[model samples]
Target chain A: MTASLIRILPDLARYAAKALTEKKLRSLLTIVGIAIGPMALTAILGVVQGYSNYVINQLEGLGQNLIILVPSANYDMSSSDIAFLRDLPGVKEVTPFYSLRAKAKQGVRDIDIAIYAVDLDVFFHALGKLRLEEGSLPPPGDTASAVIGHYIAFDETGTRYYRVGDVLTLTYYSFKRGRLIQHSISVIVAGVLAEFGNAFFVNPDVTVFLPLDAGPKLLGMKKWSGIIVVADSPAYVENLTKFLREVYGERANVISLIEISKVVASITAAMRFITIAAGSAAFAVAATGIAATMITSVMERTREIGVLKAIGFTDAEIVTSIILEAILMSLLGSAFGIAAGVAAAYALSTRGMVLQGMQVVIRAPPEITLPMIVKTIALTIVIGVLGSLLPAHRAARIPPAEALRYE
Target chain B: MTRDYRAVDGAESTLGQSPGQVPILELRDVHKVYKVGEVKVHALRGLSVRIMPGDFVAVMGPSGSGKSTFLNIAGLLDVPTRGKVFLLGRDVSRLNEVARARIRNRVIGFVFQQFNLIPRLTIYENIEMPLIPRGLPRRERKKLVLKALREAEGDTSWLPKKPLQLSGGQQQRVAIARAIVGRPRLILADEPTGALDRATAARIAALFIRLNREEKLTIVVVTHDPELAHCARKILMIRDGRIVGAEAPQPQRCIAYSRR
Candidate 1:
C-alpha cells in the first residue's frame, strides 16, 4: 500500500491542485476567512504583552522591598493606622508623607515642582534615595525649614536660584471643605539634595522636602497623602503587602513591584481570554467556509468521482486528493496572516503615545515571538484538516454504480 | 514482479488458443438483488459466462435485462449476491473492497457508452489515469499510453486537447485508448456505440476487432446494436435477468471481423 502511494503521489497532488484552481473565487474566499483569525489574535496579543512588560519594568525601577499605600475616598492614613502598620511582624520603618504639586516663586519665574512633607530624622534612614549636598536635614520639629531637590533650583548656568536659609514663597492648590483653594506659604531652605535620574513613584531630583507637621499648619491639610513602608528585605515585601491589604481592605491601595506584577498577571490572563474568544470566533467562521466550499466541490464532482472509482481509483486516494486542497489553502493563509499581523502590530506601536487632557500616556511596541507563530500555524492546519474531512469522506464513500448513473 | 510480467508476456506469443490456460474471467450462478425501499429488485438471476484470452464476446439485452449487472460483477465493480466469480481461475467473489478495486485497476479496463473521459484532463492524461492505480512510473505510463493510442488508431494530435473538445467518435477512441493503456488482461465495455452515429459506430467496432485480434486482448461488450454484436466471436442474448440465446456469426459474414 505504501509503495503504491509513493508512485501515485504526483497524480494525487495534480488532481487536488486542479480542483482548487478550478473554482478560484471560492478557494480565495476560504483562504481569506482563514487569514483573518490568526491576524487579529497575533496583533492584539503582541501589543498587550509589550505594554504589560513596559509597565512592569517601570515599576521595578522605583525600589525593592518598598510598599506604598495611598488613601482613597472616605479613607485617610491617620496616626492610629500608621501606628498599627508600624507594629506589624515584618515592621521596619514607616514614612507617612504629604506629596503636593506646587510652584515656588523665584523672582519673576514661578517654578512648578513637587513638595514632599516627611519626617526629617528617620526619613533619610528608611529610604536611601537622598543625601543632602549642602548643609543638613533640619531638626525634627522645625516645620518651616526645608531641604530642596536639584531641579527646584533648576538653572543651567552657574547661577543658583535657591541656597540654604533662603525664604521661598510656594503656592499650592487643595480642596478645603468641598471648595478648591490656593494657599501660599514661605519656607526656609535648609539644605539641597543631589541631582538624580528619573523615578516612577517619587523623583528626588525635582522636589522639596519639608517637615511632617507643615501640611496641616501651613496648608490647611487634614491628612497625609500616603505612607511608604520600607521592609527589611525583598523577601518580606509580598507578606507585608498581603497583610496590609487585609487590614486596609478597600480603604487604601498597597503598591509594590510584586503587587504590580500580580495585577499585570491578571490583566494578561484577561487579555489571553479576549484573544482566544475573538480568534475562536474567526476560526469557526473559516472552518464553516471550508466545509461549505468542500461540500459544494464534492457534489459538483460526483460524476468525476464515479469515473475515478470505475477506473480503479481507491478510496484512500480519493480522500487524500480532496483533503490536500484544504491543507494547501491553510498554509497559504498562515503565511499571509502572520505577515499582516506583525505588520499591523508595528504600525500601532509607532503611534503609541496618546494625550488625554494634560496627561500623556506612552505604550510599547508589540513582540511577535516564534513560538506564537508556530502554535497559530499548527492550530490552523488542524482546523483545515478537520473542516474538510467530512466532505472528503463523502466523496470517497460514493458507490461507483450510483455515481456512474448520476448526471 | 518482473518474472511474473515476462510469463504473462510469453502467453501472448500467438493469438490462437493455448491449451490448459485459465479463463480471464468466469461467473457461475451469479445473482444480484438491489433494495428499493421495501422492494427487492433482482438485477441478475443465476447468470454464468466465461471469456478466454484473445476472445471477443458481446452480451445483447433490452433495457433492465441485467446486462449492466453482469458487466459490473465481471469488471469487479461489484460482487455476486450468490455463486462464485473467478478471475484467472482465482475465486474473487468474496474479496474485500480494496482487493476488488485493485483488480478493477490492474487486471480489467472499462469503456463506457458515454465515453467517460475526465473533462478537465487532456487526452494524454486521461489515457494515463488507469496506469496511476498500478503505481507505474511516468516514463512507463507514457510508453503504454502512446502504444494504446496507436492501437486504438487515434490521432496523435488529440493528446493536448480535452475530451469535450473532440467529436463523439474521437472521444470514444480516447476512451478505448485509456482502457487499453494499462495493458489489462480483460476489457469490459458497456454500450460501446450507444451514443454514436452509424458511421462512428462502425469505426468503433472496427477498432475493437483490431485490438482483440492484433493485440490479443480479451473483451466483453454489452450492447443491443446488431452491427457491434455481430462482429463478436459469440453473442449472448439476455432477457428478464438471464441469458436466453447464444449466437456465433461466421468471420466472412461480419464486415468488421478479420480474425478466424
Candidate 2:
C-alpha cells in the first residue's frame, strides 16, 4: 500500500503543478467562473449580515424591554388610548409617535424630511440615552420648539446650525384648509441629533415636539404611525407582547424587539437560498471546466498511464492519482478565489449604502466566519472529485499494452 | 540470486514429462483467432516452439504472416485461443488474466520495434517499469534499475536521459535495459531493430548476443533481416502461421565455419 501510494504521488504533483503554474491563463479562466458564485454570495451575505446586525444594534440601543405598537387604520383610537395602555398590568411608560413626510425650509433650501411628532416629556422618559450633541430640549407647553436631525442642520447651514436659540421652520399640510400650510412658528432648533453612521436614513432630530394634547391640532395629525412602550423589567417583555396582542388582536401591528429581529432572520434565510442557488450555479460551471481539463489531461497522458500500469500501478492507483491532481487544482484555486472575493467584499462594503439608516461602514458580520471558509473549501473539494470522476475512470480502464503503444 | 535461479529451474522441471530439460518458454500447439462481426481471422495456427534458457533465438517472417502475433503471444501480451503456453512449468493458458500478468511481469520481459520506452519517463524510470507490478519496494526497484542501466550501458552517464534525448541505438539499449531490469527468465524482442539504421541494428544484435552469453538471459527476437536472424544460435522461420523451418542446432559448426 505504501509503495503504491509513494509511486503515484509524484505523478499527481507533477500534473497538478503543470496545470496550475505552467498553464496559468487557462487555470485563471477556470477559476473565474468558479469564483463568481461564492464572491456574490459572500458579499451579499456580508451585507445582509451587516444590515441585520445594524438593525438589532439600533433596537438594542433604544433600550432592552421596549415593544413598538402601531394602530390599525381600520380601528380608530379614542383620546383615552394612552391612559388605556398605561392602565394595563405591568405597563411602565407609553409614548405616542406621529410621523409624516414633511418639507423643511431654512432660508432658501427646502429638504423633504420625515417629521416625527413626539411627546417631549414622556419621549425622553423612554429614550433617556438620546443624545443632543448641539442644542438643548425645548421647555414644556412650547409648540414652537423643535429639534432637527444632524443632516438637516448640516445641509441648512455649512455646519453648526443648531445652537441654544435658533428657530427652525416646518411646512405642514392642514387637511381642514385643504391646501399646503406653511407654519412659520418661531421654534428654537432645540437640539441637533448626532449622526448614527449606517445605511439607514431615519433622523429623530428632524423632529418637532408638542404637548400631548396639542400634537394633533398643530401637526394636523389624525392617526399615529406607532407607539413606543417601555417595560418595567426585561422579564415583562413577553407578557407585554401578549398584553398588547390581547388588546389589539390582529388590528394593531404590535411588535417587540425580538419579533422585529425574527423578521430580519426570515429575510436572512431567504437571502441564504438565493445566494446558495447563485453560488451552486457558479460552482457547477467551475466543476465543468475542471472536468474538461481533466479529460484532456487524460488523453494527453495516455502513454504515461500505460507506462504506470506496466510498472505495477493498479487501476485504482491510476484513477486516484488523476483525481488527486484535480482536487489539488480546485483547492488551490478556491483559496485564491476566496481571498480575492473577501478583499473585494471588504472594499465594497466600506462604501456608502443603506444599512439600518446609519452612515457607517458596515463590515460583514462574524457569521461569515471560519465555518464559511471551511465550507467553501469543502465545496471545492467535492467539485474537484466529482469533476475528475469520468476522466479518472477512463484513464484507469485503458489497456496497458494499448496505452504503452500510444504515440 | 541463487534462490531465484533455482526457482526458475524448479518451475521449468514441472513442464511436461521432461524433468530437467524445460525450455524457458514452450508454446504447445497454440492457436489464436480473431472475429470481426461474422468474419473470422486466424492470427496463429498450431504454432509450436521451445525457447531454452540462455538461447538467443530470432523468429523471422513477413508482416501479417503471424510473426508479430507469435511474439505477442510469447510475451504474454495476448493469450492463445487454443493449446497451452508454459513459462517455465506453469501453464499460462490455464492462469487467470491477473495471474498471467503476474507471471509476465516476473518471468518475461519485452522489447518492441517502436522502442516503446515510455516517453515521459527518464531512462531509469523506463527500465524500472516492469518491476512496478511486482509490488517491489521503491528502494529495491531503484537499485535494480540502476544495476540494469549499469550492466546494459556501462555507466554511460546518459542513462538518466529520456528516450527522446538518446540516439536510436542508445534508445534500443535502454529498452534492453528495461527488459532485463527485473532479470526475467526470457526476453522477447519483436522486430527490436526494425526502426534502426544498419549499424544501430547490428549494435543491438551484438548487445542481445552479449546479454545472452554473459548473463545467461534467454533472448527471443523476431526479425525479417536474415543477417540479424543469423546471429542467433537458433533461428525459426515462419511462412504462414506455423514455423516452416529452423536452423540446425549446431553453434560450434557455425563458429567453426565463420572462423575458417
What DockQ do you compute for every candidate structure? 0.51, 0.20
> Judged by DockQ cut-offs, is candidate 1 incorrect, acceptable, medium or high?
medium
Interface RMSD for candidates 1 onward, in order: 1.3, 4.3
Write out the backbone clash pairs for model 1: none
Query: Model 1 compared with the native: what TM-score?
Result: 0.79
Please give the lDDT score at residue A126 for candidate 2. 62
Best by lDDT: 1
Query: What local lDDT does model 2 show for residue A287?
Result: 84
